[model samples]
Target: MSQNVTFDDRDQSVLNYSPGWFLTGTYNATSVGQTGTLASSSITNVNVTFVFPTPATEFFYFGIKRCCGGSYLICIDCDPNDRKFITIDAVDPTDDGQSPPVVLFSQKFSVAGVHEVILMNQPDPAFGGNSQITLDRFELTVPDPNAVQPTSATSANLFSTPTPSSTAGPELVGSASSSSSNLAPILGGVLGGLVILLIIVGIWLLVRRRSRRTLYSEEQATAPGPQFQSQWRPNSTFTTLTTPGTTISTTTSRRELDAGRIYSTYTESADDPLPPEYGQVFNTAGPSESSSLEPPPPPLPLKASR
Candidate 1:
C-alpha cells in the first residue's frame, strides 16, 4: 500500500486517517476554492509528529507552496540525535498563474520511529500581504530492495547536523591589518640604509675635493720665482790718443752690476803718474831724462801773516 498524506481534498477531518500522525497550529484548515484546486491556510509555528512504519524504505517527501515573498525556518527534532535547521527564502512571481508547489523537506532514514517537525514563519514586513506558506502534500516511499538509490538523496538528511562555520570576512580583515603593520618597518629600513649611503658618499666627495685643493696650493707655494734680464748700452763717443811708440783707440760701454763687484775701463797713457812700486824703473832712467822731469810744487807758508 502506498503511504501518503495529501491535504488537497478540502476536508479538514481527513487528516485523522493515520492514527500515528498529529498536527497543531493556529491556522485555517482550508482556503476559498480557486479554479480546480483548494489550498490550506497560511500557518506559523506549526508542529507535525509522526512514526515511521517498520520495514519502510529510505525516502520521505514533504510538499509546500509559498504564497508570498518571505523567509522561513524549518527545524526537525529526531530524539537520540542532533536537531537540524534549514532556512528558506521565497519570492512571489509577477505571473498571475498558480505557482508550483515545492518539496519543503526530504530525508533518508537510518533509524526512524517517531519524529517531530517544526516550521517557523519568518514573514518580511516589506512583503506586505504576500508573506505566507501553504501545505500541499507529503509522501513516504519504500523503493524495491534491489533498486538503485538516487543521487538526490545525498542532500537529504535524516539525522544530519550543521558543521562549524568558517567565515572569511574576519580572516581577510586580519590579513590586511597584518600586512599594513609590517609595511612601516620595511620602508623604514630601506630609507635608513639609503640615507646612510648618501652620507658616506657625501663625505667621500668632500674629502677628495679638499685633498685636490691642498695639493694645488702646495704646488703654487713651491714654484720658482720670476727671472730678470740685464740691460746694456754703448758709449756715444770714443777718444783717440797717441803714445811715442804705440797708437791706441778706446771705447767704453756701460752695464749695471750687482753689489758683489765694481768695474771701470780706462786707456793707458805715457803721461800717467807711476806708482811707488815702479820707483826703481824711474830711478834707472837716463840723467838727461831725470833732469827733464819737472820738480814737485812747494807747499804754502802756514803763518806768513803771523
Candidate 2:
C-alpha cells in the first residue's frame, strides 16, 4: 500500500481533519509565496498525528525543504505502548536540486496503531528572524512479501570447497619425484668423480712404492760386504811384497781408506815344514838310507884324510 500526503495552502479542511490525521502548531497556512511551483508555509513547533488502518510494516519517507535556519528537529513516535522514538536533524541543502526525500523510519509493526510525528524549528541566533520548517510531501510504502531476499551462501560455498586442493597433493608428490629424478645425475657424477680420485691416488701410491723399492735394491747391490768393510781404518799404510826382492808401498789417506776396500799381508818362515805329500815325493827321487846306518866309517876316513 502506498500513500502520498501533501499540504496545499488552499485546503483549509486539511488542518481540521481529526478522524485519521490532524495538525496543531503556530504556522502561516499561506504566508510565503509559491516556492518551487508549489504552495509553501513556515511552521514552528508543529505536531502531526497519523492513524494507520493496520500496523505500519513498511517504510516512511518525509520530504522537507528547510530555509535559512539553524536546524530542524524531527521525531517519529511509531509505537505508543513500546514507545520507540527516532529523532533526526534535517539541515538545509546547499541548493534546491541537491535535496531529496529522506526515509524517516523503517520498521515492522506488531499491531494496528497510531504514530505521531513532531517537528520543531530552531532559530539561527545570528540571523534572529522567524525560524520555520517547510514540508513538501510524505510517502508511506509497503514492500512485497513474496520477493526473494539475496544472500551470500552460494558465494561462501565457492571458497569452502576443496576441489583445487585435491589435485594439489598429487602435484606435490609428482614434484618430489621429479626432484629426486633430477638429482640422480648429480649424485652419480659426484660418486664417479670420487671413484676416479681414489683410483688416481692408488696409482700414485703404487708408483711411489715401486720407486722406493727400486732405489733400495740398487743401494743393496752396490753396498760393501763384511770382508771389504773390515779393511777400512782412520789411519793406515799398506806395503805389498810382490816377490822376495820386490816391494810395493801404498800410502792411504783417511778419506781414501774409508772407501771400504780389502788388504792382505804375506809372511814366509824358514823352519816351516813341508806337507807329508811333498816329503814323499822328495824321498821317492833321492836315496832312502838313514844317516845312522853307515855314518861311523865315513866319519873316520874323513878325519884321517884331513
What are the lDDT figures for the candidates, one per model?
Answer: 0.49, 0.46
Superposed on all Cα atoms, the candidates' RMSDs to the truth, in angstroms, are 25.2, 23.7
Model 2's number of clashes is: 0
Per-residue C-alpha lDDT of model 1 across residues 219-274, encoded as one tens digit per residue: 99999999977654453234455666666665443333322222222335689785
Best by lDDT: 1
Residues 1-306, model 2: lDDT tens digits: 233334342344332222222223223223333233222234444434443433344435344445454344545664556544344444454635334444533444564344545444444454464544444444434333454423455566545644545457875678669989999999999999999999999999999999999999999999988764466765654434354565555554433212122221223346756534333333222243322212122111111111
Indicate the TM-score of model 2: 0.29
lDDT measured at residue 38 in model 2 versus the true structure, 0 to 100: 23
Candidate 2 residue runs with Cα over 4 Å from true position:
1-40, 78-87, 96-114, 120-130, 143-306
- lDDT (Cα, 0-100) at 190 in candidate 2: 99
